[model samples]
Target: MTTTNAAEATTATAAARATGASAATDVLIVGAGPTGLTLACTLARAGAAVRIIDKSREFHRASRGKGLNQRSREFFHDLGVEAEAAASGIEHITLRKYRDGVAIADTVTFADRTPTPGMPYASGLIMPQWRTEEILRDKLAEYGVAPEPGCELAGFTQSADGVVATLADGRRIEAAYLVGCDGGHSPVRKALGVGFEGSTDAEECMVVGDVRVDGLDPAYWHQWFDEDAAVLLCPFRGSAHWQLQGIPERDADGRPAAPTLESFQRLVDRCSRDAGIRLSDPTWFSIYRINVRMADRFRVGRVFLAGDAAHVHSIAGGLGMNTGIQDAFNLGWKLAHVVLGRAAPGLLDTYEEERLPVAAWTLNLTDERLRAVVEGVKEAGVGTEAVITDDVTTLGVGYGWSSLAWGGAKAGGRAPDAPCRNGRLFDVFAGPHFTLLGFGRGSAAALAEAGEKCAGLLRTHLIEDGDDPGGHARRAYGVEGDGLVLVRPDNHIALSAGADRGAEVVDRLLRLGR
Candidate 1:
């Protein structure tokens, strides 16, 4: 508040930087949401120093972006928070639809499928966005890194060597890289002068809030559909609050009403058409308009954009938050590699090349799903179920067109999880190391060569018939004989080739780091 205090703080920061105890980090994360937290956990797991900061002084208790797709669950598993997230979230949530206040249809939000040896997380989880962030934050704390609250990125400048970021408090932090995980109206993206081109539907708006309700069953996600309006009340896992979403009546100015408790209560009363059901104790609320947009570039020099800073999707398929989380997952390893000098800086270019198309596809997919929901509501009083296709799970997403993908179609796709005598293929692929699976006894020589040559950079496993008694690993990889599959740190297949070409594939894997 005074000049003396500001001078003392600056002096203290300088002394700390000189003593290597300052805000300077290997990576400076400019947001503390799920995306930023996921990135922090990822880089920290690899022993890269990270400092995550958020502008907000207090953590949010709102129920925003309240679901995780199957692919996201896999990342959570990789981050070592699967058990905690599972304990706090529910999977296979059922949607109970109603017409004119009478129950009409009951459907599960996910496609009915059995978990196989190759795909253990076949279903998505229903958890509040706040809890997801909490889980990630808790995991990040294990690395002795916690988000700095009330610290905001005022601006930043990057040279060829590193980035110097200035905070709102007149503190300067130097880091090898800076990431923008701030949401839709990202200051980082805006400061970079990057173009965010997309469309926003002003007419299509939903009132979302967390509230305590009476006389409603907490088992199913209750949806009430009318001729022109709809409402959905979903009970959050491990919390007394139910996330309420409703299409509210617009005003003469063609804008939805404010997201106040009274307005939400009115919406529930009108759309639900239930006299017994009542809303009370509203904690958080917001009016969400459909905004589908993507930044022109994910990277500008050493500064990078990720998560909502790079892309924003409609909430139709519940992909907005998950996409951001995955964006962090995709960029985390690349940033760590470059910062740790394990890879060339050029490897960072693949981030945009691989993720831009995915964001474009996501925007298009959510738009279609939103349209389908609108049409389904008009035709059959249904919408949520229309968005539950397998495509929304993001398991089918890949980077086959990426420059890093070698070999055939299997390369660049997510490496399937398979049962092994020890544990699972994922266990072998875990951590911040490349994985080389040499299938069959014939490839043992190649595995040994890779293990000796690559050492700490790669982990080689010779998966023989005895190691996979059930033959799931071979079947999952489509390898009938000796073959080699190289998996990247992000669990994407880098190369899949026959045993005879294993030596060549190993050489190619070695070149990726350089």
Candidate 2:
């Protein structure tokens, strides 16, 4: 909650210099949302000097992004905030269909699945976006880096070596790299002249907000659908409120109407047909026009973009915030490597090379899913969770096509979580270093040599065939025999190979890091 006013910012700048804080920080992150906060925490954890700022004067209060997909859950686990997130959230809720205020069929969004030894978080969680941000900000505070509120990025110019950023309050700061985690109307992207090419759906719009309602059961996500309009109320976990989404009739100009409490009440009355469900004590509201867009490029010189600044899409799959979280996670470690001098600048290019396509794919996938849901509602009088597909979990996301991927079938994919020794594979890969999972006795010598060669930059773990009685690690990683899987700081496999070539794969990967 540090305030960055004109005088305070100037005094702080002077104090930083007096205390021998670098004239140029390693990273300057704009926007204190999930993407920027996640990146700040990652870089700070990796011992990089980072400064994160937000245009707003206070932390956001709205539960704008609520769903945390399975991939994000795993990523948060690595960041050491999974338990808090899970505790503060609900795992899943059934969507109960209602017509004219009468309940009908109930559909569960996520199928029931038990946690396997390899996959700990088999399903997504539902928590308010404000809670998620709170968790991330708390973790960032632990690193002694609180986001500077009321500090806006006015303008910035970058050179071959560093970035010089000017704040709106007339303070200037220098940084080795700059990142924009700002929203879709990103000033940074506009300043960089990057093309955010896509279309905004003018025909369809949603009124979304959080409100307290009476006479509605809180156990299920209640939905009321008629021919032309629909209303959905999903109870927010750990709160007395529910998130409300509805489609209202357009104005005379055939435009999506603005959101207001009165309008919301009217829509509810129309959809519920006098069901007696009353919405009150509104806290937040917004009229969202679906925008499917992606930045043509993710980086320009020493400056880069992540989150909504880089891409935006429909909320059908609840991928907006989750994708942003993943973007920050992917960029965090690579930026740390370059900042800490453990990797070449070329490593940074892989950020866009790996993530840009994912964003593009998400845009199309969500667009189609949104269309499908709309069509289903029009055809069947109810929309199912069929749009919440396997891809929504994001576990299948990979970088197999990237140049960094090498060796075996699992290369460039997420390193699966599995039982190892007394703990798990993720426990071994929890830190800021690369991990080499050596399986079976034949790989012992190669693992030892690779570990010695990579020393501080890599951690090698030998998972003997009998380490876990169920052989979950081997099965999870698809290691049928003696093998080695080299995992990057981001927990994606960089190299996977047979025991004989484990050391060679490690050497080659390290050379790329150099």
Model 2, poorest ten-residue lDDT window? Answer: 1-10
Candidate 2 TM-score versus the reference: 0.94
lDDT digits (tens) for residues 196-245 of candidate 2: 99998777788899999998888888888778778888887779888899
TM-score for every candidate vs. truth? 0.94, 0.94
Error of 1 at 243 (Å): 0.6
Model 1 TM-score, 2 decimals: 0.94
Q: Given candidate 2, what's the lDDT at residue 87?
A: 91
| Residue-level error in angstroms, candidate 2, position 326 | 0.5
Assess the local accuracy of residue 393 in candidate 1 as a C-alpha lDDT between 0 and 100: 92
- Compose the digit string of candidate 1's lDDT tens values, residues 372-461: 988988987875889999889999899999998988559999999998867988888878888989998999888888888777678888
CA shift of 208, model 1, Å: 0.7
lDDT of each: 0.84, 0.84
| Regions of candidate 1 where Cα sits further than 4 Å from its true position | 1-23, 252-254
